[model samples]
Target chain A: MDKMNGAQLTIKLLERFGVDIIAGIPGGSNLPLYDALSHSTTIRHVLARHEQGAGFIAQGMARSSGRPAVCFATSGPGATNVMTALADAKLDSIPIICITGQVPQSLIGTDAFQEIDTYGMSIPITKHNFLVRSARELLEVIPAAFRIAGEGRPGPVLIDIPKDVQLEMIEFADWPAMPQRECVKHYRKQDILQAAAMINAAERPILYLGGGIRHGNAHDAAIRLAEKNNLPTTMTLLGLGSMPTNHPLALGMLGMHAARYTNLILEECDLLLVAGARFDDRATGKIAEFCPGAKVIHIDIDPGEINKLRTAHLQLVGDAGSVLAELLPQVESKNRQDWLNRMAFLKKENPFIMPGADDPCMPYGLIRQIAALADHETLIATDVGKHQMWVAQAYPFCRPRQLLTSGGLGTMGFGLPAAIGASLAHPQKTVVCFSGDGSILMNIQELATAVEQRANVKIFVLDNTSLGLVRQQQNLFFGKQYFASEYQHHVDFVTIARGFGMQAFALGASDDPVATLTKAMQTQGPCLVHVPIGRNEEVYPMVPPGAANKEMIGGENHASA
Target chain B: MQALKESYPCPPSDASGQKVLELTVNNHPGVMSHICGLFSRRAFNMEGILCMPIGDGKLSRIWIQIAGNSHLDQIVKQLEKLEDVRSAVLHPAEHEVFAKLEEYFQGS
Candidate 1:
């Protein structure tokens, strides 16, 4: 017979499930869990400054490794602090397991210190949640949490264990075996053949890829299908790295902030072969007019997502990779030279123009220089705002799991900590976080955590001295009444990084900006590079909110009006 | 509290324009909350609800009467995604589950 407390059992189960790193903070309610975790030799706990940082750090690990990662938080404030990250993960469909320590059973609803209804609060945000009543329930709940987090349509799962339950003793004869990933390959053959027929018959087809492509690990299959069918492909922000940005058929990101040519190509397509991508409003501006003339064939694991946004003519409910693999055989090899020629014409006419791409000091120019210096294997993470959009536009991401950003939640302060988590997951590879002034400050405390772990994360702060995206929105739509968007005073991120015991450099302060950036990138540990950006610089070819994809605002071709 | 209660009046329990969803779910403390939370968060109006344990108390059958609209399909789809919910079957307004319980709520 085996004997252990719930806390010990939980830690043991996590070790069995191959969880090596856990990011979290310890508090009164979760002391027993910390005590049990202390004895674990294999599981390394990363102490984050805030629970939110820990949550995002775990997100970083999960997003980079394509595995379910774990995080811990105490009850009440700790739990609340981590809620944002949980919601963020839920929206993006990232599999992450959060184990929170709750107040004892007796104190749960008695208005006790550090008591909150963690279970009730997490129900909406998590894919599945558990409130352990006894130590014995730990065995079933822990494995179930892992299963639910990683199963079909992966998402965040929460397990709130009361303190008394954590300390309760349980004796059992055997440990539960780890559950195998249930790969449901049950898709209709008729649907697949019909989708293939639609693709074969269509003269102009565009493959619209999203985060689901990365989640299903269908990058190679998607690329193959695109190339074989001679389909022009446009990716959503989350699906940036599915196809190499430099590929001939790659139209880059579509919808809002997309290149004029890409959105225009989408407008002209007769068929949209959507793989693992939901038609998010940002990706499909003015849904009725998104692809007005195109027939859609959407293949996703989640049945609910099929007709959730824009209804598909053919819905192939199965894993994206599996569906694509099946559809590949039925699809005929054809060179649609007419469509390609038209796309090339649009590209030549309405190209994505970087205004100051040649200068190393400009926003687009700096992103290009960084991309040039960084190796192909380097993982890029971005915080939300104009800088994130710029990186998504300019960065040449080549493979799946290459770029990690908060696509669904659009959370600020995600880049630095997420980059740290990625660096921890892959210690040998370089992790770069492209952040902006407004976004970086939201979780700047994590700089200390990055330094302490020596996570080898290079953070580049694109300092526009404002919430640039919000300011740009006010500029375009709100009559340029920038209220509460611009910062009155500037923050010196260089000195702040140095304060956190990190190597810091300022590109604006240096005579040779390239050398400064190179030195920062070459640094062996976590470093920060602050690049000053013009406040008025706006992301061009923006589809105004609620506007049609074809109705673009600013770009090279539309510079006058 | 009185003003708050007055501001949020009880939903009309009329069978007209109502759709019934029969859900088979795991019997647990938070299972009801999970179902109701989905409806509330999605802004779908629920008119009536009835739940009872089936057979061995391990599973429960919940009947939710919601206002029938274009969003009913979406509501059913979202309910099917819930982990605790085993199956969510939508029925037309004339479904007898909530109709049979109308007598209990008539004058209470």
Candidate 2:
């Protein structure tokens, strides 16, 4: 057995677990771990300006790659700064292992400098967290952290290592083998047959895809089930890329801000086959009226989600792909011309169109331009608020794992760092981050990291001079009481990007939008495009809280002729 | 650890109003955090918690007491699928394990 310090052991174990890249910052308490990380040959570290940026960057890699990613931070403020990301990961079920440095064990309770009870603070946010008590525990804890982060219902895991622990010497023995996750049990054939029987009997059925489909990489299976059963499909926000957006069977998203047509079709469906999605409030408005007449067959890997929100007539607890594969074999083919015709007629009557056509200076037009420019392989990540909803409603997503954004958490400041992480993970591909002026400033320091890494990321900042979504809400709900949504001063984003050592282009009212945007997109390494737009630009097709999906306001109604 | 367990007195329970959740999980660091975090995230509070390493130190058993509610069953199902949790069973609130412990403490 070779003798090594605790920090050395931790890094070696992380390497043994196949951790190729880690995002974080160095602090006083965690210097030792950083030292070890610097010495390691297998693991490359990306230095993030803020601990939160590091956390989101790791999230991007984990979410896009379908593998657990790693991040690092120091004690106290570092740990607290990373907390939001931990909660975000927990909400979205993204797998990430976060390692934070702590004060020496002896000073933990003495109110030492840079000391925080990270383990205690993290208890409510992470799937699990550890305060390392001994060097030997790393042999078990490191492997367990990876296992817990990647296993059933993946989420963030934290390991807080004290400085002394990092310095302590231990005999290094053989590392543990990668732990195997317990296999989810296959659904009973009888249950699958029963579900198939319901599917065959129903005249109008809709397949509902959720985030779990992306998590399980079951998009193919979901598409297959829809095609084989002759079912039209609707997606939850996180399930956007499970099938091509333009597929005739695709009814787009349902629920709040859903297409008027999609909601109407859902209202008329007889069978609602929920695949890997929890019926969240945002996706199921006025729960009682959502798919009112439809009998639900909920399939998900998490048993709790099966009947927690809306009761399912048939609950199938297993991997989404496995369950769908099983049901596919038993499903009988059918043709429902009446249902198809109804959907077509409804779509024609209530076309889901937004403003900004032929005007690249406008919000919707800019999104369309970005979509048109984006290669089929390009990945898009968005910040929270109106931009997120607009991208979800407008972007043409043809594959899973392509759009990495915070869904359940609705986290702002998720775009730049996540795109940096995605860019790092896939250096060959282009990664675009769509952020608003308000959301972009939340963690703008990450632009430095992107420039340092020379990450192939294109950042497009939609500057509306206000929190556009909040202003819209106030306008409609609060009698146009704008409040503090608007910014008082002009911020030159191009100067800020250049200050971070990245090339930037500022597109103002007089500039030709297409040429400037195209130049920014085609530039090598990291670049930022700043576009100034009107503060009154609202994401339309708005649904008031608790309102039924059919009660949509704005969008095509407010479109300028 | 045993002394710490005894310091906190167990609250009384009524069968109709209370619920008991017994879980068996692989014994390892952070398992407790994972279990407790789930309930906290759901905004549910545990009336009492009892945990100890079981058998050969490879696993442990935990019992959590929470108020009975319409969402209890769904929460139990979620607990059963937690990363290292091998099993999660909802015991009758009248189960005397904690009650017996409380009785012993009072006698002593």
Candidate 3:
């Protein structure tokens, strides 16, 4: 027989689950858990400055590696602090397991110190949650948490263990069995055939991909289906890396901030074959008018999402990879010459134009330069705001998992820590974070964590001295009443990085800005490069908040044919 | 109120306008909250709820009364997605479980 406390058993199970690195902060309620983690030789614990940073760091690993990652936090404030990351993960459908410490079971309603109803708070956000009543429950809860997180329609799962439960002892003859991966559920052959027939019959069909393409590892299949049918493809922000941005049929992102040609092309499409994508408002833009004339065929694993927003004429419920693979052989190959010609014409007439793309000082120029400096294998993470949209618009993401951003939550302070987590997961590969001045300050304390771990992350702080996206919104929608958006004073990010014992550089003060950026990228460990940007720089071809996708306002540099 | 009713027509008062959802769920402390939270977050209305442990007490059967609106299908699909909810079946509003209990609310 084997014997161990709940904390020790939890650590043992994590080791068995092959978790090598964990990011978290230890506090009074969780000291026993940390004590057990200290004895683990295979597991390395990374101390994050804040629970939110810890959660995002785990998110970074999960998003880049396409695996369920884990994080830890104590009860009360620690649990509450990590709520944003949990919400972010929930929205984006990233699989991450968060374990938190609660007050002892005896103090259930006594208003104990460091106590909170973590379970109640997390119920709405987590895919599944557990509150362990005894040490014996750990054997079941730990494995269940991991399984639920990585199951179909991946999402965050939370487990809150009280301090007494962590201290409880249990003995068993054997450890519980490891959970087997659930097999991909196949859809009916009739459904696949019906979908194929619709694809073959449509004259102007557009393949719409979303984050599920990456989560289901359906990138290759999605591309094959698009290429086989000669269909123009557009992606949501979360689905950016599913197809190479430069592919001939690729229309890049669609809806708000989409290229003029992309949204205009969608307006004319006779059919929309949406795969692994929920019709989010940001991607659809004025749902009633979105693809008004097109017949939608939504293929999603979640049945609820199939008709949640825009009703689909045809719905295929199954894993995206499996559905696409099954449907590919049945689809008739078509060149659709007239539709292709029309798309090419739209591309020629309403091409995406970056005003200052040639100069590294501009947002697009800086993103392009960074893309040039970094290899295709380098993963990119972006903080929320203008920089994020710019990177999404300009970055040449060529494969699945290439770019990680808070697409659903649009949360600030996500870039730096996520980059660190990605770097830690793939130590040999480089991870670049594109962050704005307003977003970077939200979790700037993680610089110390990056330095301590020597994570291979290059952070580019696009310093506009304001929340550029908010300011732009104010200018466009709020009658230019920019309040609480711009900072009166700028922060010295270079000095801050140095203080955290890492290399730092400033692009504005450099004799050669390109050389300074190159040096920063070439740095062996984590480093920060501050690049000054104009406050007026805004993302263009924007579909106003409540407007139709066809009513794009900007990006009209090229002359009409 | 008249203008509001004119713009958004109310459902018929007949029994055909309502539904009773029978859910078989794991009996646990927060299973009810998980099920109800889904409705609240999605803005789906649940007019009434009744739950009790069944069989060996490891599971519970819940009966929910709801309007037969456009969101009914979505509600059932979402309920089936929850970890604790094993099965969800929709029946006509005449389901005996809630119909027999109507007498308990008589001017109390």
RMSD of each: 5.1, 4.5, 4.7
- lDDT score of model 2? 0.85
Model 3 docking tier (incorrect/acceptable/medium/high): acceptable
**lDDT (Cα, tens digit) per residue for candidate 3, span A261-325:** 99989989899999889988888899999988899998887767878889899988878999999
Q: Rank the candidates by DockQ, best first.
A: 1, 3, 2
| CA displacement after TM-score superposition, residue A202 of candidate 2 (Å) | 1.4
Writing each residue's lDDT as its tens digit, candidate 1 over A323-438 gives 99898889999999999999999998898899899788998999999999999989999999999999999999999899999998899989988998998899999999999999
Model 1 error, position A293 (Å)? 0.5
**Backbone collision tally, model 1:** 0
User: Which should have the higher lDDT, number 2 or number 3?
Assistant: 3
Which candidate has the top score in DockQ?
A: 1
Pairs clashing within candidate 3: none
> Per-residue CA lDDT of candidate 3, range B12-107, in tens?
345447777788889999998999999899898999999999999999999998877637767777787788888777774457887799799679
